[model samples]
Target chain A: MAQFLVEGRELVAEAARGLSALALRRDDAAAMEACFRALHTLKGSTGLFDLEAMGQLLHAAEDRLAALRDGQASTPGDIDALIEMVDQVDRWFDALERDGRLPADAGSIGQAAAHRIRDAGGAPVMAEEQPAQPSWRIPPDFDGLSGIAIRYVPRPDCYYFGDDPIAITAAIPQVTALRLSARVPWDSSEPYDPFTCNLVIEAVSAAGRAEVEAGFRLVADQVAFAELVPAAQAGSAGGGPARRTLRVDAARLDRLADLADDLVIAKGGLAELAAQAESLPGGHALGQALRLRQARLDRLAGDLHATVGRVRLVPLAPLFARFPRLVRDIARSLGKKAELVVEGGDVEVDKALVDALSDPLLHVLRNALDHGMEEASTRRRAGKAEAGSIRLAARVEGDQVVIEVADDGAGIDAATIRALAVKRGVLTQEDAARLDDVAAIDLIFAPGLSTAAAVTTLSGRGVGMDVVRSAAASLGGRVTVTSAAGRGTQVQFRLPVAMTLIQILVVACGEERYGLPLDAVVETARLAPGRVVPIRAGWAFQLRDQVLPLVGLGELVGTRRAALAESQRVVIAKVRGEPIAFAVDAFVDRLDIALRPMNGLLAHAPGMLGTTLLADGSVLMILDLAELVA
Target chain B: MTVRLDGAVLRLEGSCHLEDAESLTALLQTSGVSLVDLSACQSLHGAVVQALLALGPRVEGIPASPFLRDLLLPALLVKRQAKPSNL
Candidate 1:
């Protein structure tokens, strides 16, 4: 039920976005269809769950949107008013979800929304004014495909203003084919009408009837959808016949995986006992039996783990779906011609990771629009196409998901960055002069850094990139950038597949044990004080001419320890592209463990990533050297 | 001020601003009227519409007036209905 509410809230928010987009682009048929669909989903889902208040409010808003879709209103102000109502409805739903109760005056908001819908046409004199009915026609054979069909007819007067029926029909998904025919036969004696749409549509779609019907809601009076079951052999089947896959609830899959993990642990303990028995006299037979059992358990556990992981995977379509409207809005706002291209939308990742990536991706997109993309006139002058392009691509690489946002726009100017850095005191004049273009470009990620002369609401706040970097790091990811002036710029974020279990390198500082992320650890070495060389104000070691800072692990972690003995070990770690070496007493083994949150106050302590329980009943603190070095 | 009560008809008069809305509420309370005509009024504020909405009285006025029907009426209806009174 909580999950259902979360999904419903997300749908409402999407509907609000769609409505706002329609308000911004008043004549956009697609936006209107999307808005209507969102509201319809919200209403339907609320009704299904017996959320009467939410359902009624959304129903009222949906009615208004339906009128607008049919061309009863032709003003941006009308669309804005409807959008305002949608926004209020979204807020109400959010409030209900948060507080578990509807506001006392929730009904009044619905009443006001209904009135606004009425007023969108004109003021109502009294209750006697009847809403105009739309004319609709049903398509033949609509119910032949084992699906439902619905018909909507807009009043004949609908097209007199500005509604386009074809645009609304395009929003429905799973439409295998669409054939629209005039409702009234074309006749030379009929004044050769061009504006009136008396049309019947034949569409073959697998999408649910409610979703398709909702798309046509604005012209619900003039639109009709029918569900039909396709013939058993309509589509070709490979490998004998097509098989239906079972859809298991995620919670059930998780519970099963947990049980499997417990079983694996028990098997492992049994195997250890068998090995101990073999170490004694004449226990070889027991060890062999235990080995066979351990192998079988391992196979079963591995398969179960893989199945559970696959169950948590979700496609990237939801993230990509919102970009079209975003590009339209941002391009219009900036008065620039820009197009968005998405690739690898079917690539799947953990659902939780996808949710976490949303804000960072949005920030990058906004930055691309505000600062990366060049104006149309400037692009033409530069011998490039007038319309710039932004490409978003996602793919699974090794164990990480790499999402890249690249744009064919005027790239970042290194000189400008260097000048800004000098002006902002982030870098000295000498340092700025010594730095190359690539290094200068990286300065953009520095906190409180921007080359823009004036900060706009959309970008140039000097905080976005820094936040993006930190957010990526928190998820055990890193963001990198590559730019060539006048060509383009591409920003890539590398994120882990999951946050639960992480592979870490365990090291010991004095008597305490700590785990460093394997991804951040450069190398482990045994070094004496005599081998360390001094450079600048700090001690540095030369490995290929690049200086690495030497930091004592005990001092870094504030561990009480005596002076270092003659023989000591150092573990080199990199944090945010800078390398630092931590001097430790010794290096322990590495293992993959489920990272649990640290206890109370230690959770917020610096240099600590999380905590993990070991097999020996000891707790090990995972160290985040990135945070420490930063 | 021009005020009239003929059987069930209640006539409102003069400029009816937000300040005068309270008096209208008092009049409605005393007279027990369910319908009111505001055509004689020079002006009406959101407060007047709100008061009428709170009193749950059917109102009649210029139908084509954008301010009265679109802005004032809708806003008042929204506010009053969201917060219902005992009366």
Candidate 2:
């Protein structure tokens, strides 16, 4: 049942996409075939369970679609009607997911929807249910045979109507070969309904046509008769590479990832043991052998961790496929013309990142449509295309996935933002005036500072870009905006390719060891004695004739301060822009570890990114040096 | 009774009516009956066939009635062997 819901929703989305394509070009045979097949398959699946309402409705839709395929001219509303039918099915699936059955009024609602769609195609409303004939070819096993082929599809309520279809088929004279199948595949996951007739009874009878037809006299309306003859086998198409996938629960994958992480820590412990054994008297060979074994274990554990990460990678296409219709509908509703061109959706990223990025990407696109786009007349006067274009593109750059939503509409006006910031009391008038153009434009992300002159139904409610910015930041990513007057605006989100596991350089402060992100570390330095001079704020160190501010890592976390030694070992990291030096007792090994974000009491703790487990079962805090020094 | 236990096999000895569906489903569900014999069966109501299709148990014999033997049995057995497709 759960699988049905999942696949049903997917099929609905597929049909919607195909219908949208047909809406643009009715001559698209591929799109028409795709849409028809998805709906046909969905209707067939409905037969497995007690979803007779959906089955009947989809059957009507298939008839209407067949009429169109038969070269009947389509009315203007034909495509929209089909799209609406798909949407109704999608909603029914949502209800099925929640209540484990459709709503009580599903029959009436589905009937009305089917009527509307059929009417769009100028077809008469079906007053009495008609059993659609199953398009079965002559069975290949009955080659070179001559008989009357019968296919009987009983109505679901035929039992209540006193119709025993099997008895009718079995009573045929001179019956030679017979086969039975459900009109749709049966789903064992759902409880069976004995009262609903779900059988398709077919048989070959070696009798005159009149005699065969006479046998089904009681249920003639539900039977189809064909002359049995040799059926040429349809040639099979070449198969593509099989990519069978397992639908594992994401929580299970996370558990596997956690186990892999534990293995890495346990392997690190072996390294520690090897070092201890090496320092003992004449135990060098044993220590060396242990080191070799640890190295091999290190490679295997690393490979396991990487394999798990790869397993978690999901293509961004599904995340991106949701937008084209939304963009079209919003454009139509808002009386603006905009096209969303998406690219690089085939690039795979962590599944967690794909799910998290959906809302932020949507909000940005809405903002573009609502505020950035100019009217057609305005665009015409400005010598731009009448229809605006919004490009939502994603690409992998090094270890980060950069997604940008750019619109060719009126760009962000920095001066207007500066003025609005002061008017909204988000900044003082003097401060607003003093802000640079870049900084003033960034004020769009200030909470409660919306530049929209009036709140529209779409986007511009005080919670706008600030939410996008914060969401990106929570995922260890950042959002930036660039704009030009009368041209356009682009918002880019730079997010880590993987979020669960990260590389960190372990540093010791006094007796405590902390982890710093390897990407943030510029270089390590050993300072000569007396080179650290005392400044008013704190300690200052001269590096290449530039005095960089130095702070003890222990002092920042409110732990015991590190004592200045004869020679200080400091890590120079670039925070924001300037170089800052952090004094540490010693440099430990660099390793990839799973980082769990701080929750509960320490969730909002400043200057801390997260924590990880060390080899000796101790927790090591990983600091965000940029946030730490800020 | 149309349905009764014959040794280890559940047998349908006569025509099974619509009302027999409930008792057949209950017996299949409770007794853990894995094999059913239909040699003496004459006719099966649509409801009875639906129960057999739903609560599938291995069958031991074919009924004497040509309709139950040629049409209903094949339908029930084919459905039992095939997995749900078109997903």
Candidate 3:
């Protein structure tokens, strides 16, 4: 990923945001003006660097926007083409960054994209969107027709299968004519079923039959081709978003992180020396001076972390922007009228977190749209709006970022989940039946439990709710689903804002020390023996009226036997939703440590989440409660 | 297909397909007030019709093919939809 230069990523990401902003809110005059300035600035910047082709291409795009801004002409209102141009430029920039030079075909690519920008500047003509109907009619036969005639009928569940028909058709080579129409009748516009696709697309292309067919090979069976007789037909043309970034070599940033870490360790060592000096005869004054210097070092370390974090921070808009297009297409595929609403797209998170979050979040939204979101008719019948909505929202919660994908559709039924759990052999019928609603709902996070009845194109290809849960967990985060039968489902992912240099609560268990995320530590308490109670096979301690579960640190980590100490010493940690008290030898001082995820064979070691180095040069194994409790 | 975007007019020669719709629309958009000369056009794809319709360009030199002529003229013929231009 580092090979893709940071500057290239920044340039592409910023341009993509601006282009999408213009595309999405064409009516927002301010956003449109910003887009013009951004494009113009990018063009001028590229020209300054002597990237002639890029500068020229962006100039053309800016010209169109200039016309729109000047009110010289109406905006073309084609978001797809504008997106394609910026996306193409992004690829070109990637090639330039990787090879230290632009590809030989850069000129042609830019010229082609320039034409698209022009087209995108055209006025709006396509307004009414009729639902797809079964169109088996022979493709239009026109005079002097000299290319391949194609009729593509996408599978009703193509969206589930992760196939985008719009993109596929839009990318066809040498496209001459494309007619996207609904094959299905408009009987129920009051509450349209968007999930049920009744649309068929027929296109005429100047591209050869083979090129077009190869492009549609994913759904070959759904396409029919009619070859025109030997005549001169024009050939096809081709074309192909990133985030805000500060241009810094990723290697240098890594080195800075390492140095900051080393400084933190060195600062700890100085404090130790200060303590030793304080013990010396007549060393009290010297010790105080060294402590002041150590305090300065600590401040510097924090500043360094903040600086590096800002350099790596990126707005969530680029990530969130991708979903609306996806949900819109998938909704169209399912014939379900679903709209994606995004909030707090301007919220910034670590770039690495954004990348890590993309795939799993996509999967969760797929489930939300397919299984979680009910049909329009069902929604209407349930006294809900006909148009179901999914929102991709993000916010900063303390030091952590909370990203949520919420839908206003049919929510999960715990009974259905339990039944599936039993049916899928995930749990015994008796066990599933004994589980409460929350526990049963959590069972969806257990692998192999898909509520979808059949393997459709959109989802139910075996990867289930547990996959979504595990993905969040792998990022040192947790996912929770709260649903009401008729309401929608929200899968919230709570993750630390930064992956490096987090504050951890160090604890000692006998001879060994371990680290736990400070955020997870609710409180530390020394309880009396009488407060500990045995519940079933496990032990619980009464915190207030509620009894929290208790786990022995020595027993959970398999290091030592649980000693029957006279006093119960413990730290209360939040595990899932419940607070669990873990008995430890003693609580050590809290320290800001950079935890490195355990890799290779030890990565999946039971109970260990990650490992961090202490000032004393010893390794502290961070514990994962899910693994510890299991 | 040949696309000429410079000069006082944007020119398209030979047969053009739906795939070229974006390029053609772009040519018209970036061309500003330049006339889209399609007189040498042997055939025009359906997507191009929509692209041209959106732009409402002054399409010069209408093609001889009835298939294109019928679709092209009706869309560009409506003066209310297109800008005032000499036919």
Candidate 4:
């Protein structure tokens, strides 16, 4: 299905990112494993869809990566060559997605990848004397499976959710009989979700059933896994029975849904016609027959819609798989020894949400590593464990999902923050003196309030945490931080289950009405123009003795100032860590609508996040407050 | 040096300058040159000596010039003694 291919492409991109990062770090093992995971998934999935050209290229890449993984040979040059091969494969996948056909010269890239693998052996030992093809099969004598045989069946569209099933399965130690399959039949006419992966792996290992289940805990729902006892009559053969798994394209799935909806409407019309026919004399038999046919058709269409919807659901494991390397690199860069503990990785959300979460989660993890955790020496000096730990736990909280990033290191110092607040003039000396430690520590969220005296290239410029907050908020998510001095910092983000439909508050700025994301709006108030007072070159109004900066909506959107009225309403928006009040013409009612980005050149307009259509058929520009501040 | 067809032996009579290719060529016209004694010869040019060396007659040296005799002759002798087919 199209979803499968999309998921494969994402995996390839992720793998490419990992390879490039590792290539920079000179970590051969991790780079090779990442590459192998990507190519292996592509190869297996492509085979399922009978995409021969793509499958071949991926298979070649898999071989090359496998060689490096096994330490048969590896060098910086080899890594570069392999990375290039992966990039080419990515381009091919993109082209295929755009054109629905493989490129004419697709085999060359695969050939190049294979050549690198052979060349890595250094001066080919003449063809006749070369060793036998490296075996991919599990050895017959190897019997490490003392535990149960658990089969993991990922939903067919798992890939679109950014879950790399092969990588997750491979991470399970002593995995035996790993097989990928589709949950349903492949229909070229039907649209499929590319994110869905229906890969079932029958793994036999020394790891307990709970551990095996826990290994796939992040994708447990989408993955249908079962523990089975090995039959004594069976031999040591690794391959599982071949099943004809269904593959469908995504466009077709959409068409099918539309078709089903149309059929439902038709059935409704038939039901009404049947009632009319029954009212006529001697039409009872015809009415009964029409109703029976309508019922059957309705049931079929309902089943079709349900099946297609299931095909769209994918587990989040693939996206989660990419984070271990990210955490490792970041922790190493910060000179902090921290282990990433991920939970609820199997939790399935909509595929689009999973993809959107990747960057935000990465930013959060990076911030946790750079600013949340303290160095080992510092931790030891503070009488804490030398090795710090970061726990990234995710769970379904009601309709929303909460991902919590907790780190154990030197926590936020409230006194330092209070001093910074006074220095930055965000709070007067008198006000700062009255603030408690908890309130003072919140000042860290203030833009440009960094405790570090000197800014390093890695972090501490005071821009990272703000970016993290903005990114999370953009997805209708809120991030909250709790820290204790000498203890640690815990940052938790609560995000919506899906992004297609969102509730937004529409506000009028000038002639144009804009939707200020409800998540970012703290409150709105009416302020008289005369009440706006000057504070340190910036105009601020004294509300509760706290000076909040006044930003005019007209000025922000490049509109001419409107004539002053008796009273002006200012929408106080929290951006980064600072509060800025935007003067708007009037408040508009809230609406729930499908948020879509504007087309044409206007989509690139600054401070405009996206565009949405209102119930009255008018377009509303969604304002990005963070962009405005920047 | 002059030799009769009646199996007569001829000896090199005087010092000959290997650098003088014209004289060597003129000498070859009158008599079949044999037993070249290069011991007293000094500063033999490569061009004139190569001509004589290719004349297909056994070469005897009064001793070659010191630089040429030490550096070039041993290598030339090895080449000459080696089987051309093998090379």
Best by TM-score: 2
Whichever of 3 and 4 has more DockQ, that candidate is 3
Off by over 4 Å in 1: A1-5, A9-41, A44-225, A229-272, A315-347, A369-393, A406-411, A457-462, A484-489, A520-551, A562-567, A570-582, A597-600, B1-87
Tens-digit per-residue lDDT, A1-630, candidate 1: 575555565565556556656756765654655566667666767766666766766666666666665555455466656655665665665567788766778777777776776676464323321122223343443423443344433444445544544334445666554443334543434332233444444555556545676787666766544333243312211112333544467678657655654444445456677788778788888888878878887788767666766777888866775564567577878888887777777888876677778888888888887888888888999999998889999998988889999999888999999999999899999999999988889887888786556787777654668788877877778898899889988999998775445778988877888988887888887765676676664566765677677877777788764455576677887876787888777888777766654558775787788877665657788888877766
Which docking band does candidate 2 fall into?
acceptable
After TM-score superposition, the amount by which residue B72's alpha carbon in candidate 4 deviates from its true location, in angstroms, is: 98
lDDT of 1 at A607: 76
Minimal lDDT window, size 10, model 4 chain A: A231-240
- Looking at candidate 1, what is the lDDT of residue A79? 64
Runs in model 2 lying further than 4 Å from the true structure: A45-57, A91-113, A123-243, A276-284, A325-339, A375-389, A422-440, A460-462, A499-501, A526-536, A561-566, B1-87
User: Interface RMSD of every candidate?
Assistant: 21.9, 2.2, 10.3, 37.7
Highest-scoring model, lDDT: 2
Q: What DockQ does each listed candidate score? A: 0.01, 0.27, 0.02, 0.00
lDDT, candidate 2, A584-629, per-residue tens: 8899979788887788999989888889988888898999887787
- List fnat, each candidate: 0.00, 0.47, 0.00, 0.00
RMSD of each candidate relative to the true structure: 23.7, 16.9, 22.7, 32.2
Residue A405 accuracy (lDDT) in model 4: 82
Worst 10 residues of 2 chain B by lDDT: B78-87
